[model samples]
Target: MDKDLNSIVQKALLGDKKALESVVEEVKDLIYNLSLKMLLFPEDAQDATQEILVRIITHLSTFQGKSTFKTWVYKVATNYLLTEKSKKDRKAKEVSFDEYANQIDTGQSAMIRYTNNEGEIGLLEEEVKVSCTHGLLHCLNPANRLIYVLGDVLDLNSKEAAEILEITPSSFRKQLSRSRERIKNFLTAKCGLVNPNNSCRCKRKIDFLIDSKMIDPHALRFANHTKRSIDMMQKIEFLDKTLSVFRSVPIIGAPNGIMKEVRQTINSITF
Candidate 1:
């Protein structure tokens, strides 16, 4: 944390209402984005974000400042998400290699292709890239998912991630390596975008998705209305180039109005 943020934390812990409000405003996006990635649904993300903000406020005094406030906040957010994942109805879809391969087979000799002149193809590809990559995360257990998110998606170092996860650095690295290997093997064996042997194409899925009423072009939830696209390629450039496909995918952020409400709820509190 910078000196300015450190000062805000001190004031917030000391019962400065404005400072507390400022803290909420400053970290709202971080909390919301993390929750959105973990929960993978807008409504669930909204609820998790609100709960996380309240937890941060409620536990502000327990912060020892041995680590940066941002690190502490991430630890809190991770613990909550892991706990929520353990609850019933939160079980992630398990995709076996056979099942994954079945989804990638185009059936016919040629896979469907779309032209850029229509404009909708680009939007569809954007959605496919984001959704497909995020979907892959769900195939892993919650612990492995957290490791992948912290180590690869969010690009935190092993030491930092281990600290946040409260695990040994070696243990964190081992889990992260296994998670990467599992995802890489699956992608290489199945996804055409990642491997030449695979025939699956995002363009082909667009028609099926639209016909099935899974995606509405009129109101695209993941790809539109954002100031900037979350290009994981640019963000994770420091990683191995062979795993660039995962890095090229995007992670959607929280929708609008959530931040304002969360901040208000935090500011209204006496603490």
Candidate 2:
């Protein structure tokens, strides 16, 4: 997609309609793919894609080349999709996980996942599927999820991900870490995914702080022994069921561009 956007953006900005059209053609697939990942509905995704293209055309003049054209275009597509999602959520109660699975339409496409060189370890194919679905939903509300998908799953560099999100690279990393924790928590609760390495790693860190007297042992005691809380066993069982939903439902199918089209259509035309 980046390869496709280069000359197209340069030529399009130079007042070449054909070049601009070609650029759209090149990135339309990407725009829509990401949109569908973000929006999860073909109609919504299509609108978002079309609207993004129009915006790209309008903003061509303002694209100062601070980032690649693909980055700018991605921001356009994702930002619009996020806005539409927020608007809809504000209008009504949000969907539950089951609702998300049952209501969503998957035409056999899968979300690309990222793997660490540490290898699969405890994560099996089924685990990946559950994690992806849970992660996508975790990210659907904030555009941050898409950013992680681009950065983590796609293995895009921080600068590239930052460019797409319109945030500083450092900021992108921070949010990405938070997003990772968020998805992990979501999955842990949904799939009984202990992620022994990661969990034990966290436990070790916590223990280190305790042994070093960095944390208040009293607080730890209260959190674990004093307050009534969901037992670890129950939590694991809950997450296992949650993870099961993805195996049954599937995630990472198609992208939407409907909002993109609408934005393009409704906005004032610009060169």
| Candidate with best TM-score | 1
lDDT of 1 at 155: 82
Collision count of model 1: 1
Candidate 1 has what TM-score?
Answer: 0.84
- lDDT for each residue of candidate 2 in 141-218, tens digit (9 for 90 to 100): 556667656765455788888877778999888877876666556545433234433222212223333344533434
Error of 2 at 140 (Å): 5.8
Tens digit of lDDT per residue, candidate 1, span 142-217? 7888899889878889999999999999999999999888888887777666665666666667666666565676
Please report how far candidate 1 places residue 40 from its true position, in Å: 2.1
Model 2 reaches what TM-score against the true structure?
A: 0.53
Q: What is the TM-score of each candidate against the true structure?
A: 0.84, 0.53
Weakest lDDT window of 10 consecutive positions for candidate 2:
221-230
State the lDDT at 89 in candidate 1.
Answer: 32
Model 1, poorest ten-residue lDDT window? 106-115
Write down the lDDT of every candidate, Cα atoms only.
Answer: 0.71, 0.52
